[model samples]
Target: MLKEELPPEAALDGPPPDADHVLQRTLGTVRRERHDAGRRRGRVMAATSTFMVAGALAGGVWLGQDTGDTVLRGTSAAGAHLAVQVTDTEGGLRLVATVDGVQGGEACWLVVHTKDGRTFTAGSWRANEDEVTLSGSAMVRAADVAGVSVMNHDRTPLITAG
Candidate 1:
């Protein structure tokens, strides 16, 4: 048929549509779209979890860096008074033990230890000083020993003194 010979209504309905073919194409498109959406959601979740873990690790590093050296020393006598010293290197905080009416013939020894396994031992003479100084790098902790008790009144324990 010549192009000019076709009527207007015939041109309007030029090609017959295929219903089954159209439905299949539409269903395939929907399925692909749903699959892509699921993949996008999974990626988002994985990215979020990665970010959370990284943040936690960064926070832990910051906390560890902020904490510095600590020192603990303890002195005690047989049926007498007890003395303790606690120092925080990060904050330069010092707490001296208070012992009232220490009598003669009192046996006392000061044992100092660090979280990093550094130990310092001194006799009652050193404990009599106003302040005992600890050197080297270590995390101060309470010293554990028999016949003596070390308690942390303030700050974290980095060593144990017996």
Candidate 2:
């Protein structure tokens, strides 16, 4: 331990820092930190809410959906293409069928066959264009559906698929 002496020119005592200013700065820092924390919490809540809503929508879609296919596409031996969407409606089973490559100007029919050996007509239309879309419903459940077909007005099958 070596002893050292202070210079005479050096001021031994300086004025203490202002207490009020220090207090105010400390309070301001605390308030700013608190405000930042609040903003962070708000952002977290918003993210959580968004995720929750998305999960709820996904759940609703999963729970309220139909059992049949959204789309079933097939081609006939005559080269016509058939696409169908089968859904369950309150009235019964609904079928949306799109037919393509069939000869135009012919009256065509959409039919649904049930597992119980019953056939139901869905809709009919004139094949006025290269492709046509038809929609109809039957008073049968999707579980009871056997197959679907598009036929000529004379009941000749044009396209068939299950």
Candidate 3:
């Protein structure tokens, strides 16, 4: 059939009579699609970043709670230094203390007394570089140990019991 005798829809199936107008319309559609796609990508990235930041904050809070049960205290004497740390474990209390700076032949002593006057002392003397750890269900009684004391070369109380 002759082009002039065809309907508008059939005419559209043939090559465009005006190439410039067709090209302009196609380019406009492509630009609009690209803009919409960029907007969607930006939204997705923003949501992902927000989720990451929230997750980090939650992890920090969880870590803080996990380590919140421990307490640490430090003191120094004329010839000795002491550091004490107490933590609540699953079964009982855990107490750790470190002592340093004693005479070459001097001995370090650690004594723990409970509120009921029950005392638990190291049978043998501890060295200056040794770390003492005590664990037991009755360890809660350690709250009454007060503090550790150090003795000097002349058997003088470098750190008084408190």
Worst 10 residues of 2 by lDDT: 1-10
Per-residue lDDT for 1-162 in model 2, tens only? Answer: 222464322335632354356655787899999999999999999999999999999999998976655566779887898998988878888889989988888888899889889999999988865788778988988878888888998898889878
Greater-lDDT candidate between 1 and 2? 2
* Per-residue lDDT over 1-162 for candidate 3, one digit per residue giving the tens place of the 0 to 100 score: 687896443555654565466666897899999999999999999999999999999999988785543444445545455554555556545555555554445654554445565655432254534444433232443455554445443444444344
lDDT of 1 by residue, 1-162 (tens): 898896443546543353366655787899999999999999999999999999999999998884442233334443324445554555333334444333433333344444454544432332332333322222343332122222232322223334
Error of 2 at 125 (Å): 0.1
Each candidate structure's TM-score, on Cα atoms with residue i matched to residue i, is 0.33, 0.58, 0.39
For candidate 3, what is the lDDT?
Answer: 0.55
Q: Pick the candidate with the highest TM-score.
A: 2
| TM-score between candidate 3 and the true structure | 0.39
Location of the lowest summed lDDT over 10 successive residues in candidate 3: 133-142
